[model samples]
Target: MTKLISQYTALLDKLDRLDWLVPTLARLSFLAVLFFYFWNSATLKIDGSIFSPSAGAFGQIFPKAAEAVLYDVTQLNIFQRLVIFGGTVAEFVLPVLIVIGLMTRVAALAMIGFVMVQTLVDVTGHGVALGSLFDSAQGLIDQRVMWILLFAILVFKGAGPVSLDALLRKRAT
Candidate 1:
């Protein structure tokens, strides 16, 4: 136990010294791949639509309300379609902002929101179940929790001394 604890402590110490750009780039790369995967799925129309079945039924039940939300004319199921559309937009926009380190906090926050909602939908609507904390799709989706935590760290750390964000901050001062 003592040996394991020491090993973990040593690892954490190494992490502490890593340049922020390394982690930032890693995070950006991860998000970029995720974006591509989701975008490709959306483009292929792999599913019936992006909208939830419940949402589509709701639209059918309340056409007026659906129309008010601009979901009336949708043929591919409003909820599913909207989800795909929203995801596509986020995939395109957020990664760019994150890669450039512009408004990174805001982008990370938005990403957290997106991942949360999608996870909820997948769990509740699709009947996806998680077997364990580390092996579940839920855990994978909530991996943003880690990213958000990292982003919070970055916000405090100011994107390190070499980032565009840091450069801008330096210039401002």
Candidate 2:
């Protein structure tokens, strides 16, 4: 019994020593989603002109409101347009920072906020159905909650030793 307990403790310690594994995997898994969903969207939102979106980018980003405005998002004020652009940029930038583990804690926190706003837009602006939080993955909110949890973990634990943030910390020490 004593030997079995000792071996179990040793195994738990080994797992603890690899604490970086889950956070790194979370960031990497996020990367797969970003490459397809975000980079593609970002590229679509920008054409040859700097900061200028293709004709339909805004309509896609704010579909419901755009329809209310007869699909002319240009009717939005300068500040509103800038907000859209900023959101688009963040959707691209924040995820990249997280993947590289540079300023990962900040990036993850920002991502949490981003996820919240994105979910809000989906729910309020697009009229997406809200599922009960306790209900099994019934709608977009549940899926987003899972994403936020991943970001929250990084926000608390930070990038692990394999990350750029960790490397910089070591050098600074």
lDDT (Cα, tens digit) per residue for candidate 2, span 1-173: 99999999999999999887888887887787654576677777766643775546666667666777876655766775786788778868987889899999998998899778877777777767765665745666777887888888888888877799999999999
**TM-score for all predictions?**
0.54, 0.85
- Over 46-125, each residue of candidate 1 has an lDDT whose tens digit, in order, gives 23544333334334334445556765344445564565556656756775666677766677667667667666655555
| Cα lDDT for residue 73, candidate 2 | 50
Off by over 4 Å in 1: 1-35, 38-73, 76-84, 135-158
lDDT of 2: 0.78
Query: Model 1 TM-score?
Result: 0.54
List the global CA lDDT of all models: 0.58, 0.78
Off by over 4 Å in 2: 1-3, 47-50, 54-56, 134-138
At residue 141, give the lDDT of candidate 1.
46
At residue 131, candidate 2 shows an lDDT of 59
